[model samples]
Target: MSGLMQKEYERVKLHATVMNTLFRKEPSDSESPRLARGQRKTRESFDARSVLKHFKDYEFGSLTIPNIHLSQRFSTGQDLYYQCVAMAALPKS
Candidate 1:
């Protein structure tokens, strides 16, 4: 992944991890109004937005081996024993 992608991921992760604590903690009366206003003003709109906008479609590099072979070889629990074998057989792109 590019530096830009890493930066984006970290921004989103920080935003989410920070919000996780905020969401779980009980807000004092003084904190509630400011918090609600922050929600309204923030471009993300909500905590879910931070998480949803990032990581959903992050790169999963191409697996060049035939999809059909992968399916046939690893589709069942018994087949998983063969995945490492199949995986090692595959040439790195």
Candidate 2:
């Protein structure tokens, strides 16, 4: 899981860098006003390190994985069964 997370983080960082570079380039006069404004805003506000830090913190920092163990004891030749469970923490509204 850690290895996969690291790879995803690296990918996101690279994508952010590419997007920032693209945003930094000036658009031609024929470009739409809305697009030009959006690009300007992104160039001014996008911080790759900050974005990466947020991603790391959200995915790794606050996440919790509890250790779960299952045990079974059978008597009188009865069968035993167990079901898998999954849980997630959602933000409170």
Candidate 3:
């Protein structure tokens, strides 16, 4: 699983770079292009700890992961499960 994830991460990084190089247009002399918020976030360091609690909510009656702070009640375990899934769906770099 780790190997698979590493491959996927590399694939996405390469694809992003290629797409940026091939399709991104240069700004006109009067304009400057800025990276989108999502692009900027992608470049920022990812703190897995910040999001880890969402994953632990998958366990029965668990309110928090070891290192993450608990903030609110989760209405149902499934809700937390989906949150974990969403986090997992994000590109890892």
Question: Residue 23 deviation, candidate 2, in Å?
Answer: 6.7
Per-residue alpha-carbon lDDT of model 3 for 9-93, expressed as tens digits? 3333211121223233546624866667445322233356766777766765634323322122222254442122112233333
Better of 1 and 2 by TM-score: 2
How do the residues 17-43 of candidate 1 rate in per-residue lDDT, one tens digit apiece? 334332344446467655553253333
Candidate 3 pairs with clashing backbones: none
Task: Please estimate how well model 1 matches the true structure, expressed as its whole-model Cα lDDT.
Answer: 0.39
Query: How many residue pairs clash (N, CA or C atoms closer than 3 angstroms) in each of the candidate models, in the order given?
Result: 0, 0, 0
Model 2: CA > 4 A from native: 1-20, 23-45, 57-93
- RMSD of candidate 2 to the true fold? 19.2
Q: How do the residues 1-93 of candidate 2 rate in per-residue lDDT, one tens digit apiece?
A: 433212323333211123534235556636745555324344365557977877775654464435432222221122333232323355554
* Model 3 segments more than 4 A misplaced: 1-42, 59-93
Cα misplacement distance, residue 85 of candidate 2 (Å): 50
Query: What local distance difference test score does each model get?
Result: 0.39, 0.39, 0.36
